[model samples]
Target: MVKPATAADGRWDADPLLGLVAGCYVAAAVAPPVVFAGDAGLSLAAGGLYGLLLGTVLAVTAVVWVAVARARSLVVRLGRSRARWLLAVAPVGYALGGFALLGQTGIAGVLAFFAGLGAALLGIALAAMAHTRYVAATVDEASVEWDGRTGWPERARRRWRRGAWVVIGVTAVGFAVGVLTDRWWLRVAAQALFAGGVGFAQTGQERRYVCTEAGVEQRLPVARRLFGWATFDGYTRTDEAFVLHRPWRTDLRFAVADIDDPEVLADVLRRHLD
Candidate 1:
């Protein structure tokens, strides 16, 4: 059983199975290397694909079971927003169809897989652009005299450059692997994994974040998100990051050096939380 991550407050995180959900995709990406680390890697990429499928199955099964268990209370608990949430099923449906189509042979399969990969990244960039384009966005992120581009400009800039470099390097390596490998599936896997790496790097770029009376608003280049104080139960510091522990299993985090006026930011963050 997947255990829920505990906040300092000792409450269960709302999503107990987020790791499993994420692992489904992660498994898909790493299964190849796990099974066929050697030169003899063309077993239909059988290990990679089967592991992916298994993770998908487990994730879906877990989600379905949880949904069913809570079905009776969903509408009343979720209220009028239930319909809006249900509409999210459309994307899940598309995900299922998209993956099924990827298994096809010939040009159709290639197009479906790569197109889907590109579309996801494109969608994020477009969505982020929409926040600033459509929403009247402002920020108190730089509230401290030492905040924003002026103080942390170099830090954020370096991070952005690093993210770009990682994606470029991964893409180059994927291309070389695709050419040298005898298996077509290997090529597809390499590209897909590298594409995911690109997405990860893109996400690492510091979003335009603002602290407000209600909470925090993140205006990322690829997406926008608002997180109320209630969304986070506590804060935790690790060697690498300062984390806002969310109700969900995952925490939102920032590097200590990435944001300007670290001490001031920490104070503001603590003050805002309920």
Candidate 2:
């Protein structure tokens, strides 16, 4: 979690002006590819390469800037402020403008624009989610009862394996159809199905869980999720695991063996649920 900056610590307070500057930098980095493509008569691939180079340079520059003690404070403040949302809009507008400019070039340019836009949007979403998890982990007065890594329970593993098998079967059928019908799109669909099946098979192969005062945090390989106390009605304890009951979502099961002290963990849950 990002700690608040302090004058006493010789750190400057967050400045909204710094945030505006950062937003401008981001816009400049992301918004020039389409213009470059049109003016230089560049191909779709060249436009994408140019965008990648600009984004990489900007990321490196931002990293160096944040490494400075005073600038780091400003970055933390910007992340926590409402102004950050407004800053995000500038990039979206520029990206849309770039897309419009690319449309005049050709269909290939339009497709390249959308592909880059999709990747940029996804990266932003993941960064936001990670920041939220970091903040949630540092909730005030939150005590951590148990923290460890574990895999899915036998029941859940069996269910996932069954689902994976079904998906794999479908993928096989799709591949056969693609070969018989000589359809490139069908082949692409088959490849996607195969990837999904593989992902399903690997789901929950490893996970880290933290039971804290404010909530339970589950960290997967690429994602972090928090299940707050208010979201769950209660929990049920079995010999091997604790199952948290949510009103509208699937229950979360934590293995008892993964906890250092099951009784202490139970006490923490009781204090919240009871």
Candidate 3:
């Protein structure tokens, strides 16, 4: 679960001013394509009415994007197959309504838009739901012994060192792409990748994780988190991931390679939860 933060401190992932501008930018980007691609019968000659309609469309887009961006989960988990199907129905409903209203230029274009839109909205809604349902059981956060300041586990240290170099190489490729394509966005993405690589490298060199009897304390450039057995509803270990299940939401994921000692960690978790 995400730790709650107040707006007073500069702890937000996104800057408010920039986020607002980004929302508006997204609104503008999305509306024109839809309106221009629509039927010939749709008129924009009435200046006042057209402006009002366009504004409304922009407003809706901004709201949806901002809401989804601020939403809790990046993906959704409905817990069961049948429930998932039920979630899909809402998007289908959106498509139907869109078809009824915007299908003037034949069913094809309308169907494409509505279908894509419905799917996107459904995914966003599910993620939001997962975020909402996510919870961490109560535990003694204070008095938690943390040896993280010493160093990362030896295995994790090696992995982090390797991963950082790989990421930096990727960032270089991204930089090259941006230069070749003359795309600012590409450069921005490259910058983000570089920053992440730096963070990873620093994590390896800095104080490591806090491993305790209760759970593991994960430290990042952004925040410190403790995931304890007291909250473990279930767990699934796979080749790629170590998933810890708590209540309500889907499983929490950690890279399998990132763990200190997988066998020992698994045993401790099993013992405590049992």
Candidate 4:
């Protein structure tokens, strides 16, 4: 279990699981580049051997880094922002996907395929575990002011309803066309559109939210998000909700009516924003 952030310094306990996940991410990120470098080095007489040796050293370094308590602490500190932590791992996914494509058509292809699949599955598991642990720790340790469920604003819900219909229509048409034309890519696109339509259809569903001194926790239908005070620059109040603004990311909207004490929530936000 992860430890909550201490009130004194606001630092969380360095959980070993966090360190292990970080180390695995580091290894995944290093592997593809190292393999490419080794391939490139084959042109030189001894460059391939050198590249292999360098890769081994880096791999060992990642393992040792995970073993150190201070290093784990640093990783835990950095991962405090769940959004940032997840974003950091995105490149690993891209790298693994690219490697899988590059090595297609041989034993190398099979290895890359399994590697990518395993990494993706492992990443999901690690993220879920870390998020659960941190949220539990936060709730246990922090002063929670309000905890309840909220729905999207009526206006937003209406917009999503319209959008969902359009998406579903397009998906149906696309699928029909793909079937007639026998195009695999078009079928894939239609499937993606259908998935998106499902998301749009769920827009007005009620979601749980927790307001605490540390941050706001949003438990949406598909995922749980913890938005720490540090993640947002400021917020704007609407008739129905308070919108937390962040740079280059979607803003978080908390329904004011759904919260029991608006003034207390406002004060809590003010203390953090100020």
User: In lDDT terms, which candidate is top?
Assistant: 4
- Badly placed stretches (over 4 Å) of model 2 are 1-3, 6-33, 36-104, 107-125, 140-142, 172-196, 219-224
lDDT of 1 by residue, 1-274 (tens): 1122224212223333422332233333323233332213444455555564456546554554354334323322332122433322333333445466555433234333443454444333333332332222333443422233211234554676587678768777777877887666656667767776666555444555666654666655544455657778888765555677887454566776666567776777777662
Full-model lDDT, candidate 1: 0.48
Candidate 4's TM-score:
0.56
RMSD, each candidate, Å?
Answer: 15.1, 7.2, 11.2, 7.8
lDDT of 4 by residue, 135-247 (tens): 65555434777677877677777887898989999999999999999997698689869978987797666688777776788775544567777789998888898777999
lDDT by residue (tens digit), candidate 3, 80-133:
123534443455445445556664544334543455454644444443333223
Q: Which prediction has more favorable lDDT, 1 or 3?
A: 3
Q: Which ranking of candidates, highest TM-score first?
A: 2, 4, 1, 3
**Which one is best on TM-score?**
2
TM-score of each: 0.40, 0.59, 0.34, 0.56
Query: On residues 215-264, what C-alpha lDDT tens digit does candidate 2 reach at each position?
Result: 77776665556677888999999987888898876677777766667887
- Whose lDDT is higher: candidate 3's or candidate 4's? 4
Cand. 2 TM to true fold: 0.59
- Compared with the true structure, all predictions reach lDDT values of 0.48, 0.61, 0.52, 0.63
